[model samples]
Target: MNVARLMFFAFMAMSVSSVSFAQDADCEAVAGQRGECAEEAMKAAARVLNDRYEALIDRAGSRYIFQYQSRHEEHKAFLDRLKNSQRAWIMLRDSNCRLEGFENEWDKPSYSADLNRCTAKMSLERALYLDGILPAH
Candidate 1:
């Protein structure tokens, strides 16, 4: 009788342990899905911001070209300087964001999301700055 009771308790313990393991797996799977969803959302946001950046660049470039045609040599040099500054700004933005991604192991899932968010934020700021400088239309 004692042997049978021992076997029964062992069976119950094993059943409980299996249920616990399954629950753990389910939780991990759900967490992974949530992480993926967040990453995709971040990417979409970055793409939209990048489009805004490009639009601002187009407007600024058009303004610059118009001004250049009518300006003196000094003004033309100033415009050239602005062009150089913009190229440098692009390099800076990319490098800075890459460094942010590397802060916690570059291969991690969060790293790409961090990089995307950083790029989006920097581009948006640059676009706003360009828009502020552009001639009001």
Candidate 2:
């Protein structure tokens, strides 16, 4: 109700609404910090893709009662691809972790163990790539 309280609430809302993982950083670093960026990317990508699909669905839904033509069938195809891509990306992110361990394969057990940190690093790099951000060789 008060200004301070309202501001606090607004901050909390913004914090909750804004995802913290999408940043411009090194993909290797993101992959190093979190093996799950692939997962996050998958989710984020799916959301973006799904939004597009949903829009089509809405238009098609107007034609059909519950099911969608361009929306439902098209999404089915997109969803399958998205799942496969997400899984592959996660695997790639996890596999990348091997490098973070000083190239020590024995350092980590599985990618899920440190996927979050690694994913964050990956997300940052992806953000850069999307922004035309390139890494120095």
lDDT of 2 by residue, 1-137 (tens): 45765565566445423544342233346656444545554456445434544454343445333444445665566556645755676587657754554433445534443444455455434332222211111
Candidate 1 residue 96 Cα shift, in angstroms, is 1.7
The 10-residue segment of model 2 with minimum total lDDT is: 128-137
lDDT by residue for model 1 over 1-137, one digit each (tens)?
A: 36755565566456434543453354357775634544454454456455655565555556556655643555456567667878899799889988887875556767765665566556545644554444335
Best lDDT goes to which candidate? 1
> TM-scores across all candidates?
0.49, 0.35
- For every candidate, C-alpha RMSD to the true structure in Å: 22.8, 13.0
Model 2 compared with the native: what TM-score?
A: 0.35
Model 2 spans > 4 angstroms off: 1-70, 103-117, 124-137
lDDT of 2 at 119: 51
For candidate 1, give the lDDT: 0.58
Against the hidden true structure, what lDDT does model 2 obtain? 0.46
lDDT of 2 at 84: 72
